[model samples]
Target: MKIIKYLLNSTCLLLIFSINPIRAQVTIGSDIEPRNGTILDIKQNSNTGHNPNAEGGLGLPRVRLVNPNTLTIDSDTEKSKYIGVTVYNTGNAGVPEGLYFWDGNTWRLSVSVSSYGNDGQFLKSDGKGSFDWSTFVMPDYKYHRPTQISVLKSANVKPESYSYQRLTDGGTGSFGGATPSAAFEYLYSDELNILSETANEKYLFIGIAATTRTKTINNNVPRTSYWQIVGIDIDLTDKNGLNVRTLQKNQRLYKTAGGSDLRSYVDLFTIVPITGVGKGSYTLKIKVYNVENTFSRNTGSEGGNFVTTETRFYDINLVDINFILYEDD
Candidate 1:
């Protein structure tokens, strides 16, 4: 009876060992244990430079274990093969070196981007995860000033100059207030085609400006006059189709004082710097709204010749918007 019991007990122990049952606590290593859900675990006793990575140091792969694995070089086809592999892009003749990973469609990277702020603001480091946002005084670039811009000959036409013109005053009186003159539409846009070799929106549209002098002319209806900038408009276009920026309220230009106009001749043309110019063919033009007339205390109006004579040749400048050079990246 004792012999038979020993045989049965031994057989049961063998079966239990053969059919191993599953357990959740999968621990390894003699000293350390698994924390949780660890399918595989490894332990190293000492540190040594067993294998050097591409950097010639005992550094691990640029990224952790990735699906499909990294290829040694950049391959447009390999990207499709791997589908979801990540690798340190070892730059070649035409390729750039960077940390990138493949998704289903394209390789993505953690690219650094530019930060911007108001003129008086700058960047600061917090010695932590993020940069502290603020402003700093930039050293004056006191770089050489660029050469004066030359207006293209194509835009220097005569007939197209006075477009969208309309005298809204009902003679015998003068008035003020913006006339929603659809006149902007009448201005010739042929000059708009090529004021520059560059794209349209890239050019800054400083409105037309010229110095002027007032005189009590010997005429039946005597008056004095001056000039001021009015307003501007902008537009843009791209893959999405044509887009138009509706004109904003006209900006009023005020005289700060000084200067006498030379009779019989208009002052040299100047550019009245525009504030908010953007992308597209701006095709800037000057429109004199109110022709100022201070009468000789007696005559209420200056003959129409005053309006025609003064604004003879003041056209705005079209400077390229190359602000990207100074932009923070």
Candidate 2:
């Protein structure tokens, strides 16, 4: 029975050798001697005498430790003795129960860490073997952080009308997406969803509309205030007087001359914090004023109502109004 001298601590071997001849090689686990081109080979099992591949599997020694993996570390003597030691875990849920080893400092797992998740999903562990695999929570999604949400809305009105009839094509909906929401309606006003109508949250409102009209004016200064564009305003059912946003300070002329065709747009935006008096759903409203058929004639009075032709706050046609509401904070 030959053995690798390095593996055995025994000193009973003889050193007899022929003159100028090489030493014989060592072989183990086989009595027929190792095959050519082999140095130290491990083959058949010692107890069963069958080849290693034909048996159940190769086996290694397992050491049972006393109170393993406490927050208090083990002593150096225990660390050195258990350095490459494999054990069946009777404790420590953070590691696998099948195979764990002490790599001189900590215990390592021999199992897999990728078997719990699928595509578009990731494994979230609680620093233990337990994991939760779910869909990725995107920051830009509406359910996540403060995202820019756009509502595709439109309203139609005649020349000089205060009633802003919400337009509905039976196919379009709020949020500018394909998904139709019942909260937005053509016959009813739009219920702007701004996270929550509660306090401590801030909101921003911006509105833009294109106006189409014609006016007649001779002097550029002796004003023709027929085709007028005013600021956009919002009305809160719970809080009045512009808490979330009241009106924009924008005014323009859609017509300036006798045959001058006017095509203009009105843009208005404002920032509002909800720490004020309003605490309910927000409704987008338009601002209207009664402009007496007054011409700003720099003749006698400073921009006074000179020519009184007709007096009425008639409605004007708004091609489309784009209302954008988002969280400022």
Candidate 3:
């Protein structure tokens, strides 16, 4: 009887062990796209008069998880159009992780971290500007400076002498604004200046501005910075995409400021950079927004003109011309 009892007991223990299950807490990594849902409660209660736009329009919610199980939104607005997600963890063990949003063309890192109580609802923004989510992350605005720092590293040109042809919208009669407050501002770097190979001559001119390329300066920080084009070269491409007959080396001041990415400019034939510098001394024809359906050419008819009118020729130094370069990655 004792032997039989021992066998039954052992069998029962084995059965219990086999039926036991292990629970795996999912650490939603960067790829998980959250679903978009309206935070009706916040919307109805918030004081901000602006109606927030909805988040996560694409197949997946625009939000992504960056750190393991750490969800953050990086904003302080109590009610704003924001990326939303659903999760299983709640209560004391459910510390909210950082959340990220994917802007249509690119992924925007969320600026805040949210917490879900035992009820599984995200708490409102924490009142710090850091948590504000109303302004969507713009990959275009990711970096205000140039991405290629190597290009400017060796350049020792004096200020005011170095100039570039800034590109903007031809329609606006000026540069476009990325924000409402800073409309039509120049987008070039004030710290940069360039001299043309040719100067003090009667010829069309172009300007080349400093451009920067960047690498991760600090990786431990979660906030993302970007490589930006920042400035432009003074030369213009004609209707046929050819540069105009202007001297290969001339200078022009890029006076317009503010606004990133999209800007305006005039047609090729008319001289630009009209207002900023001394008359006949500087004019900006090319802008950042010169890209589009309009045909490009090497002549003014095609929105092309001389980048410079100076008598100095750059043929000898052409071999070492640094058109493009990057910093150490």
Candidate 4:
């Protein structure tokens, strides 16, 4: 009877143990069970009920590393197991103090610290995975002058044949007339060459100064002469035939009327800024166009009584032409 009783108690205890399975999880600072799939859970004590102002933190082990490239672990087998290990480094032996991690072969700095750079210096990436402090560099300014100058003048023809009438009983006429003829001519041009060594992403600043002189003759009837720079174009072309033209039109130079043997001179100055230029062999060209109006008119009833005017372009001189290159922002 005593043996049966002892066996019955043992069987009952075994049944109770089998019904409630044992867990390998651990929970600290609280009596609650550890979360599912978690081997260890740590939190602040909740003895005084849940407190919103609870303060708790986990601190990593601090160490002083002599060199980040070399690991101090003597056992190669043990070092392999510390590939993902991380620690806070307290500066020592020239190594900066920061968070570092073992990257299988060496320890690498995990954070960029301001203490690594001096004042007014910036941390720059090496395009790889490394960074270093670098000093700021200012933009450089370069100057270039025109190498060649040329002009394309109008054909030596009568003033009445080349020029047109500006005002009459009819109405206001077009500046260049019906079609672009000798009346509108390419007066002047300046060329500048940019070599490959000086080609870069920059701003091309162009400064031009030109002077023009004109002569007009007035008969018995009222006669007038008008001549001006109708257009200014900058043609930039590369070796591969990439062309870009920046043009300004109707830039007046001179205008006068109703005087015999009348001579007039005018000066023109302009500055053009061209941005976003790329690296290449480029030809910088400036083209200036001349437009004039000196047509003859018949005022009297007879055809012989014709009022004819003669106008001529004495000179179109380029006083100064300069090109400057500035680094683009």
Q: Cα lDDT of all candidates, in order?
A: 0.36, 0.43, 0.28, 0.51
How badly does each model clash, as a count of residue pairs? 7, 13, 81, 0
Model 3 residue 151 CA deviation (Å) reads 18
Tell me the tens digit of each residue's lDDT in model 3 across 146-230. 2222222233332212111232222223223222222222232222122222331122222244321111112111122211123
Name model 3 segments beyond 4 Å from true: 1-184, 187-202, 205-207, 213-282, 285-329
Overall local distance difference test of candidate 4: 0.51
Which residue pairs in candidate 4 have backbone atoms (N, alpha carbon, C) closer than 3 angstroms, thus clashing? none
The candidate that wins on TM-score is: 4
Better structure of 2 and 3 per TM-score = 2
Tell me the tens digit of each residue's lDDT in model 1 across 1-329: 99999999999999999899875555344345544545643433322247421232223245432222344345445656766566665444333445566675555653432566567666664432134357665695533232233343334423323221232222334323333323333121222322222322222233333222323334222222433433333333233434332333243334322333322222223323222333224443333332322212222353422332222312222222211111111
Q: Cα deviation in Å at residue 99, candidate 3? A: 96
Mark the regions of model 1 whose C-alpha exceeds 4 Å error after superposition.
1-150, 154-229, 232-243, 246-288, 291-329
Those runs of model 4 whose alpha carbons end farther than 4 Å from true positions after fitting are 1-171, 174-185, 195-201, 211-229, 239-242, 253-266, 290-320, 326-329
**What are the runs in model 2 whose C-alpha is more than 4 Å off?**
1-189, 212-231, 239-245, 252-259, 262-264, 275-280, 288-315
What tens-digit string does per-residue lDDT give for candidate 4 at 106-182?
Answer: 88877574467789998887553346789999887664443323332223111222223332222244323233234
Comparing 3 with 4 on lDDT, the higher-scoring candidate is: 4
RMSD value for candidate 4: 18.4
lDDT of 1: 0.36
Residue 221 C-alpha lDDT in model 2: 30
Compute each candidate's TM-score over C-alphas: 0.25, 0.32, 0.14, 0.34
